[model samples]
Target chain A: MKLLSNSKIWAVAVIMLSGLVYIGSCTRDNDLIVPVKLTQPFAPNRGTNIHLPGTMTVGDPTQWKMDKAHSSVLWSSNYIGTAGLLTGRFNQFGMHDVAAAEMLNYVATGQPLLDNSWAFNEANPAQTFFSGYVQINQSNTGEPGRDGGCNISGMGTTPIVAGTQNLTVTNLAKIKSTKVEFDASSNGYIVTFDLTWQGKLAAPLTKSIVGKLNYITMTTIATATPYKVFGLQLKFQFNCRDFGITSTSIADKIDIECNMNFNNK
Target chain B: MPDSFFAYAEWVELETFFAGYLLVYAIIYLVALNRPATGFVKTRLLPNLPLAYAFAGTLYLGLQLKNAYPDYTIEHLTAGVQLPYLRIWGLISILFWIPLLQKKPVFSLLHSLVFFFLLMKSLFLQLFTSSPGNDMARNNMKIYSISIFLNLGALILVTIISLLIARFNTQKRSTGI
Candidate 1:
């Protein structure tokens, strides 16, 4: 009886002691510290022109140009719905300008072109053309970059109709190239590139081409010594084609120049 | 686990646990006042087990918050930030253990009151400050409140039963067998 009573007393004592210790240890205030932020190149600004490499017999490559108003093809798609389906009309593709920040993300993370494997057939010379799109980052004094090229033929042929003699094949391909160089002053970067496309029209009696050009520059201003770059300038070129003919081509560009003032307060 | 959700939930649980502690302590005190020693021990000790469990629960929650935000600062642990729950839990710990030292009914009752206030504060804060449609918050609040209420209720019931049993034993002892 004595031992049992003593044991119960000890149990209570132990519980009380543990609780006190826990409370005492937790009473002290914690100290505050600054949070860390990430520093890396933006995804959209990492690459040169974005385009797929393939030959398409539908249109002549000679019609392409650096000027925004004269381009022959254009297209854009953003998966906005919960099911990831295209929600907007295909005709409104290039009407809205791509944001510079978004472009930077694309440049850093996207691939621009499709390879030759996307071709329909090597035997049929006329039908074996490849078609794709590319986004290029080029500067007169810096590195040229590109992304977002899709080649349907490179995706490999899948027979849509097995029993019928007539069959439909789907192919997608993509590729990209970039060049980087510095000037005599070594103060700025320049990049440049030319993109070509050749392929059979996916739909007979109808021709379509999608293309875009964007020019951007980043410059730093001194608020503190050895200033940081925070300014961006951009221009765009778009093109579209219908029934083997160029129907719409538009150019839009915006120049944004601002100084980096770190101590604005 | 979103940091904000976890922080909010922890605060709620902390308060509810404290309030429960206070109610239990009060009930235990009332029973101890009129009851015999054996009756008091048997009725009070078992139900009080939840008090310890609440402490353990709060400790686990604190550890989780710590893990989620490794860079959690002292300011974050204080009044306005994520882990104010810890402060309430700390108070709970004091109420829980201090009673064991005094071994008096009054001290135990006081501890229960503190627990009750903290738990209520936790519930109120969660209801007012937390974002709506949080199923976890609602469920947790319900569980904590119900469990605390049930535990105290059961303790009181047991205390009443024990008192009756003691009375019967005493009447029998006073009379010649």
Candidate 2:
């Protein structure tokens, strides 16, 4: 009742309100929020569909190399309180699912490429795995100005890297498969991998997600050489708050759908 | 948003709502411009102190919002909109305090122009540029148009408020009320 009588309290309230704005700008990265575990096996969805130019093949996963020229990694996240979805693509990425060194060593010895000589056995689906990394700085959300947030760590922005601070932290987003097995329900291979994200204020956070993998055959237009392409489509949702990103404009639930194509060189 | 006060109010709807809100404030400011101050806060130091703090607070808040889009924060006028804290415009903000302390209507109007420029300069840069991503995300509502409209509308209200505040102080001294 005496609030209006005291100007000092009103002034202090005004100052404190302004202080809250500054606090809102800083990302919360100290305490990690537990991520929802993925118990269900991956199934084929519209996002993961691979329109093969040729036909399906029973190829060895170990022999496949990443076709960087044709493969792409796209990320999409829903905007908070709106039907809008923020979509972007990472320009620079490397898929090292198949061991190139061992494949090259076999070729250098004038020996035919065989599954037995490879690092992992082709007969066992569990041994078949994939590992890749994405350059955070290279994220292009179509808008060059919006891509600045990608440099901080996650696909979000923080006040720590503004103005004179202009610090560029190379936080490479990485993924490595821990387990791979055949999902008889979907009649496809299911891969469970650790998805790691690094933020400016927090250490790297890892969450396991399941993805669908399909092997398809494609013929190169230049040489007409038939090669096996690894159609690995990973569709999963992650909480942005877990990575210390609290952008009010962007939704906390990030829907990630990656359709990567890897082929033998 | 369904249960919230701003239900169905997306960026476009909010922009439209704020524009009308500022218009109402601008009209109230016009009416207050002719009225004399009856409050005991007549001293320049007493009144100008809060204005100075408000300016700093607004600038800092604007900078943080711009920080949300880092690339646009660089050299405010050239990059995009928000706070150009490090640019020449930031130094110009200091001049706003001079007119407030002096209590001169002429200088106050000039200071209002400076503040208006600071707020509206980014509107031009953002309006002309084309961002495919922004257009798609906003569902063709055109975020640039919304920003330009809000910035212009807000500045109009701010300039009017500045004039009304100057009128109150000057009228209070002249009328001895």
Candidate 3:
């Protein structure tokens, strides 16, 4: 009782509380790691040049439709704290899907080429050789605050940055060898495309991806009705910083996987 | 799980909560630090800026720990920081950081009780996690239990002595000539 009433005890107690607050300030990071990991070379600065296998071939020119099948993008960033990780995906990515019914025989069997005929259309006169866009508003990380920040705070309001700057159709009449390359190997196709986020016409990034022909059909049974699925699967990892998105709390690496499931009909 | 909305929602909550807490700190600075309305911005609050940041950061870390592992207790050792939760240490930091009450001398029992309450909560949790599967968790549990016991013993001893003294007084009153 005497000790409890002692002024020294209270003084000690106050000091203890203050001590806790001090320790809280110092803890900035946790080195804890999840067992699952995605291994990529550490290039902290900006440019990452990845090269894949195969030879380039030239093929026929045509237009490809960009619609929403299951063509969504998934991204994970570093959490605010040093130890945590955050993951999220876009619900609506308007570009990247093509109807399954459309013949993908060109990609499956035809010779791989320096094809820039992705956006060529007979209906439109101002059509370019290859073009598509990603809507910026479609960026949703699940958390409202995070989604809001990604849209407004870090990167300014630019819906889509042209991956290739040479969009002038007249200039793109002749498909340039240096601009794009598609090499077919025994396993799949090695597509070396010029992928830029904010600027620069030529940023060659090679990815060994399975040909769209490999996964031909997907079935969806809706109790009474069944539907088949088909489309291209595009996967790539790029640092958000390259796209002018400045964020200290998030990991620079953003992995985008578009499993485009075109409509069966 | 890489793309699940709920997968990383906890981190978003952590960021939002900490940022929100900054506003409260600002209010405290205004109310306590800005006494006697100075012509120029008060310099007294300047020194406390770092301390305020420290309090908010650490508290948010604690909250982060809580969110990540709802099993958060005094015995919980943080994996990344490798720091065992010594909760009293946290309380001490908080109390010392309060510059406004730094000079004030107040109740000792109340402070002791507050610490005791913290210890009690941890002890309850320790009873369930006395033996954890992971070595880190087990070691942390042991440390947490020891700290609680030490504090409880001191607190009880004082109460016991006070009770014994009261009993002795009653006996004297009844048997006195």
DockQ metric for all predictions: 0.03, 0.01, 0.02
How far is B94's C-alpha from truth in model 3 (Å)? 89
10 residues in a row with least lDDT, candidate 1 chain B: B101-110
lDDT of 1 at A25: 30
Candidate 1, fnat value? 0.00
Residues B1-177, candidate 3, lDDT per residue (tens digit)?
012454324323322222222222233334443365562223334234334433533554576566568676645534433222333333343463465643331222233343344433433343334323233323333433343343333324434554577689999889993
State each candidate's clash count.
Answer: 78, 0, 23
- In candidate 1, stretches whose alpha carbon ends up further than 4 angstroms from where it belongs are A1-206, A211-265, B1-18, B21-104, B130-137
lDDT of 1 by residue, A1-265 (tens): 3432223443344345334433433442233344566765433333232222124222433111121122223223222212232211111011112222222222222122112221222122222222223221110111111111111122122222222211111111111213223322322333222222222345423122222222232234455443322211112222222212221111121121211111101
Displacement of the residue A130 alpha carbon in candidate 3, Å: 7.0
C-alpha TM-scores of all predictions: 0.27, 0.36, 0.28
Q: Which CAPRI tier for candidate 1?
A: incorrect
| DockQ winner | 1
| Tens-digit lDDT track of model 1 for B68-109 | 586566656453445654555445543443446434433434
Ranking of models by TM-score: 2, 3, 1
lDDT of each: 0.34, 0.46, 0.37
B1-177 in candidate 2: lDDT tens per residue? 122333323322322322222222232333344445643233322334224423543553465456556555446535433223323433343454555543442332233333333223333222234422222323222332353345444445455577688999999999999
Segments of candidate 3 deviating more than 4 angstroms = A1-69, A80-84, A96-131, A158-186, A199-227, B1-177
User: Which lDDT value does model 1 have at B57?
Assistant: 43
Query: Which one is best on lDDT?
Result: 2
